[model samples]
Target: MDQTTARPETQHQSVTFAEGLTLDCGRHLGSLTIAYRTYGTLNPAKSNAILICHALTGDQYVAETNPETGKPGWWEQVVGPGRPVDTEKFFVICTNVLGGCMGTTGPRSQHDEHAGQPWGTDFPPVTINDMVRAQKRFIDHLEIGRLFAVVGGSMGGMQVLAWAALYPARVFAAVPVAAAAYHSAQNIAFHEIGRQAIAADPDFWAGRYWEHGVTPERGLAVARMTAHITYVSEAALTRKFGRKLQDTAQISALGDRFEVESYLQYQGSSFVRRFDANSYLTITRAMDLFDLSADYGGVLPSAFAGTKTRFLLVSFDSDWLFPTEQSRAIARALNHVAANVSFVEIKSDKGHDAFLLDEPDFHRTLRGFLAGCAEHAGLS
Candidate 1:
């Protein structure tokens, strides 16, 4: 599907909800506003609603303008008319997560009532469950009693699983791609390294420097560069650049002018221009603390004990960040609970990013799964 032809420039409304108070991770967050974009109209019965959860560094713009970068939406290719998501038939909605910087209430948002500046380090820590709780309020305000499906990848996928476990009756189906039920020790370690890198920067100033005309640009860039490398496979890096010099003619004794280094440098620099360091800390911390099974008596199957929500779990062959084993763990738990679930380990060399990239097999499976869901709901 051609996203340009399917998606029109549509207006989005800024919505807020008083979520009473969040008790997840021993933090209380009050009065949250979620920035969301919706496409298609809800039927009279409101059964066609589909919630899209965005990954880390992504916002409410799924198939439209990105407020931060003034660029096109991130997941345009797979989420439009005739696309796998089929926006024409489903009322697609995507929201900026609770700790997001893109228009949603987060650390970067102003706390003028308290200090006349951004919340920054003053913002209370948030978890994936907290993000899901905020999203539930948004759905309730929209008067959507149930969702056709909740779909996401990476951290977005974490939210999908959290939704399934937290609100089993409200979600009809879930597609958690390239995500794990718990944050692996390795993943948490990587996040800690990034956080430490940011904290070590003199300009960080415990996140208070954003309002003082100082940005931790270099720290954020290095963090992004480090994380970006984990998102792709070794094979991809080797194939794309190898040890090739950036400028073949200017090869000197000066170290590391390789194409890979140049590529990572560009990626890191571009990311720092739009993303906030504080927001990065908040979101990554949420991801690191995510452990759905821990709350369910350490029995992963018990988490989905009585849920009827269908699940479609997917993993890429080279996705070391959230490998095939993680997806299989989810599937095995669902199986142990006798829940309706399907698993697919797609053969891709793109690693964790395969979920977001062009993978015909993944698209085909998604189309089939969505069609099945629609048929079950009698929407097709």
Candidate 2:
């Protein structure tokens, strides 16, 4: 369960491709290992496959006990038998994305040609398109011709957009929850702050910390803490922690005086235990580089011109990170092209993390959307 170390094969299902992948940066990976988890049964026709992309820092333990954290799957609330994304009716496939630390070919993965040393920063700079390309290859490996749906939020939602735009014919329904077509300047600035924090750590070793017998956990933790703030709303934070003190007693200089401080500290510390610093650098770069509309001369509609895929875009009212306007822009683009698409702004106080939380309205919307799509797709 060491986040930066090689995880045993028993921890998850994986497949290695000898030819590897051609990354967006034009580097060729000789051997690719995709660690993934599948829930429910693939129908005989293989038409029920739903690729559930994970957000940043998430792994392939979608509906199982996470081997590293020993906690229920991140989406356990919505993706189980008799739940919203019912396993009884659909097959769910989640993979540890390229540039991730969890059993995938990433910064921590050994370079096949180089042998012992890890890829570290040498791992070819990955893009959102690159991540989706890897996922598409994995789906082909599973021998699934087309997917019933491609679903995700935040970073995962970016992947969903990439999937739909890159391979529209292969996706029957695309649900990008709490996502945008490109990285906003503010989001990029936040990510830059995180990267700076990691680099400032003396133990970072220019991202080659694996050779130094130490990890840049402090810097990584700080990055997590900073980013975690953007994941929730001020309203939610006030309701949960507010200005309450961690202890009623008078505190020392370095002591965590505020309850919020201690909470973020716990979050940061716990994150470093289950994540790798170098991989964090690699993945965030990928997220920051994502821009679905730039390829088509900044015309978002041109990207989906003549696309056959059905789209359902969801956003939370309080999600300033990937706000309602972003989703609306996408909706307008799809409308311009007369593509099948629906956009919704779910009422919630959870901010950007609303899709991952226990919001009944979000769950209902998802269930209803998928159900309607299933009927259209001839799913029983």
Candidate 3:
């Protein structure tokens, strides 16, 4: 987590599509590249694939030691040999999303149409559907006729839902954990605050800070701090840090020496080291624009009018960001369509981030659901 530490070079596994793709915004990216990592072997029938969609800040390292951070994969606890979404029995593929910094084609990637400079702000606006479409191209290239499962949390969960909606016949099971069918107003407000923080930094340079040979570290760090606060519950913050005071040497900019402030500062500093400011802006905006019901004339059930894809929607009790009520609403819509759906609101103190943590109940539910589907699919 050291800001001064030099991370190792990224060893990317990616494929380029020269045919390119047209974006939802009508912009065409010529020769798009998608970086991903696959764990477990693809079965001969190609029916064991399970796509892992990461959150806003997550990369493709779902079940291995991350080369850049040297840290264990994000979901290593729930995705190993005997875990919930066991890689030993499933071809687990995780991709750094379209506007991601971990080797995916994004705002920081060089513009093919431009004269080799990074796209920066010139990058065309993207939506959640665009991200799912991009992933579909990669899956088609891999010759996967259908994915056995699609799983994700937060923004990644949005992509999972989009995948099921756009290609219902392709996804046998869709798990959207700690996510909603649409971004809430408060969430959009939170994102705007972070975006303003980035823009307010003079170093942002209109999202072209790389051209100045400087990162908008201060702005990006503050933005991360803000978002991180939303990820955890107030009870968790109190339980972990209380009003505990940090040493005077670690006093914050506001002159407070609280332990929580120090922790958030550490998080922000570490995030800036691994994430791109423009990519953060791009992804958050995409999340804000996500409205799965918009395509169905605001009738949520109509979106899944005839979906055969089974759904498991997970929510955390303390997740104020995307509350259980939102998950319930989606479940109700799925029920209205008589689509196979199950919803579970996990009992956890860890707010919106409960899905990422080691929650036994959540894991049990996911495991049982996937196991049932695997049996139905005859994977066992």
Find the 10 residues in a row with the least total lDDT in model 3. Answer: 1-10
Writing each residue's lDDT as its tens digit, candidate 2 over 1-380 gives 11233555335567878788988788899878888888999999999999999999888998888876777899998899988899999999999999998888998888766878889888889999998999988899889999999999899999999998899999999999999999999999999888999999999999889889888888999999989999999888999999898666467898888899889999999998888898899999999999899978999999899998999999999998999999999999999999999888999998998888999988898899999999999997
For model 2, the stretches where C-alpha displacement exceeds 4 angstroms are 1-10, 248-253
Clashing residue pair totals per candidate (backbone < 3 A) = 0, 0, 0
Instruction: Return the top candidate by TM-score.
Output: 2
Taking all chains together, the TM-score of candidate 3 against the true structure is 0.96
Give the per-residue lDDT of model 3 (tens digit) for 1-380. 00111113765777777787899999898867888889998999999999999999998899988887776799897787989999889999998899887887898888777775888987888899999999999899889998999999999899998999999999999999999999989999999989999999999999889889999999999999999999999999999999998667464578757889889999999988888988999999999999999988999999888999999999999999989998899899999999999999999999998899989999999999999999999999
Regions more than 4 Å wrong, model 3: 1-8, 249-253
Worst 10 residues of 1 by lDDT: 1-10
Candidate 1 ranges beyond 4 A from true positions: 1-12, 18-20, 112-115, 248-256
lDDT of 2: 0.90
